[model samples]
Target: MTETITRTTGSADVRGLSRWTAAVILPIGPAAVALLRYFLPYDTVDDSSTMTSKVMAEPGRMSLVLWLGFIALLTLVPAAYSVGRMTRRRAPLLTAIAMFLVVPGYLALPWLAGTDQLLWSGTEAGLDANTITRLAETPHPTVAVAGVFFVLGHVLGTILLGMAMWRSKVVARWAAVAVIVSQPIHFVAAVIIPNHTLDLIGWGLQAVGFAVVGWAILRLRNDDWDLPAVA
Candidate 1:
């Protein structure tokens, strides 16, 4: 019986630690991305050569931006996982589906970031911008597929996770709504309108939403944050 109680206590401790870790990390990725957008403000509609030129013009700033982007990508999966954990009890299926979508989507980001490095290297080598652009834009079918997955996964997955959070009632309705609407705004700002200010605002909303959620999690007792272990 003593061993059994010890096992139960250990389980509870692990669960509590997991919840705390998740809450602490949830806002990091989006906040980093928002900062990146604010600092870099790269024009998405520019051709590869133009974009490369812009990066070359400010190599120091570009390096910072790249690091920020890397941080955002690194933390995204954990942020998504936190959302899944928050909603799982009340909206298991939705959380499951969102995780399925976001894991692959977030994982694909590093692959896409390779373009930035390639462009920077090409410029440093004094390669023709047009030639570098052509090489970068080479129609690799695998990359094309990953791009599709990345787009659909992040946008759709985030929306679904927000819905799950709403259904769970773990966070305020406004916070959940903020999370839900953020991605659509990001999509429009980054793709359709290509406004850096709007992109910053969009990612800012996500950061705000996750910040609130993290606060709520912090306020919960360990037992409330996760199921108590039964001896």
Candidate 2:
């Protein structure tokens, strides 16, 4: 009886975790991402010199970017995991692929971007302009590879996950649409807007997608909590 109770408790914990991840962490990540983008210094990507200058000009403001990014990164792991759990039964293969891609991709960019910026913010006084320029301009191959994965994860993974959710019929159809449409919408907003004015909109839409997904997960009436059987 004790053994059976322990097994049941473990299963309940897993279900609870999935629900918490989907409902809370997932939505929080996108909102944090939006806040990070909105607070970033202007034209940090313009050039090496411009990037260095901006970092030095406002270290305090730049520091906020790193903090926000850290929060986003923290939430992304569970968000991705919840996506996997939600889709595993209906679309196992695709969901597996999405998790494989998104886990690393989503984690890498934020950590790398945050580290890259923090280096400048933390030690502007000790570092020289030439050093800063070199650090800023030098291309790290690892970062390039990570960027590819990150793009694939967000673009492809999100779309696949959205499709899986739709096909599963566990969530409202419009929720799937929100998750699917957010990426391209963000891309278009980035292209059309100046000074990243639409960044809030883009990120806001992503948060909405997660929020809708969270709600859908909460509404799941399955005895299994819609979780796939783990071997």
Candidate 3:
């Protein structure tokens, strides 16, 4: 009886942790990133010609942003795990596939960010512009392959995961739809407005969607905990 009670308590703890992770931390990464991209100091051309000089001008601020970005990427693991868990009961295969894609996609984000930071730091250390440009333009074949994986994983995985969540009915239907359409809407708005308005829409959608998911988790009864384990 004691052993059974202990096991039950452990399972409950896991469920609680997973729920909080999904509802709270999951949304922070994308929202923070969107804010960073749109905000002052960190704001600039996506791949500007003057990157070296920019890095030299504000090395401290750039370094802080880089570390913050890394922290944001770290939140993806728990977010993905909770998402997989919530959808597994209704769409096991889809959830598993989404996890496979998204895990690598998020993992690659920090690596890419870190790589960029290192290049900029190197420039600050008097590295030649030609060498930096060449390196950025011609990444290793493996890095290039990883970049492809990163892009596909995020784009395709989010769609699949959002659909799975919709089918699972784990969150509000509108919230699921918001998650599904956020990226495309953001992309379109970015090209059209080319301003912070895109960031507001992009991050707002994510915040609302994740908040709904979290609210739903908070409402879960003990009976709901009998669902399939997250693979």
Highest lDDT among the candidates is held by which one? 1
Candidate 2 lDDT by residue in tens digits, 1-231: 353222233343456566655688778887887777777765434566766767777778778878888788888778868767777888888788778777887877753584457455545556866677776667667877777887788777777777777787667787777777766666555444534546766677668777877777787754557444342
- Tell me model 3's lDDT, rounded to 2 decimals: 0.67
Give the Cα lDDT of each candidate: 0.81, 0.70, 0.67
Error of 3 at 20 (Å): 3.0
- Which sections of candidate 2 miss by over 4 Å? 1-14, 43-45, 126-128, 189-195, 226-231
Over the stretch 1-231, how does candidate 3's per-residue lDDT look in tens digits? 353222333233465555555678767766666655554243333453355556656677677667667766877667767777778989998898988997888787755675567666776778776666556665556676677777677667877888888989999899888777766665555544556567567756765676677677767763475443332
Weakest ten-residue segment in model 2 by summed lDDT: 3-12
TM-scores for all candidates? Answer: 0.87, 0.79, 0.76
Off by over 4 Å in 3: 1-18, 39-48, 186-200, 226-231
RMSD of 2: 4.3
Ranking of all predicted structures according to lDDT, beginning with the best and ending with the worst: 1, 2, 3
Residue 128 error, candidate 3, Å: 4.9
Cα lDDT tens digits, model 1, 116-210, are 76776776788877877887887467777888888888899888988988999989999999989988998998889888888889888988888
lDDT of 1: 0.81
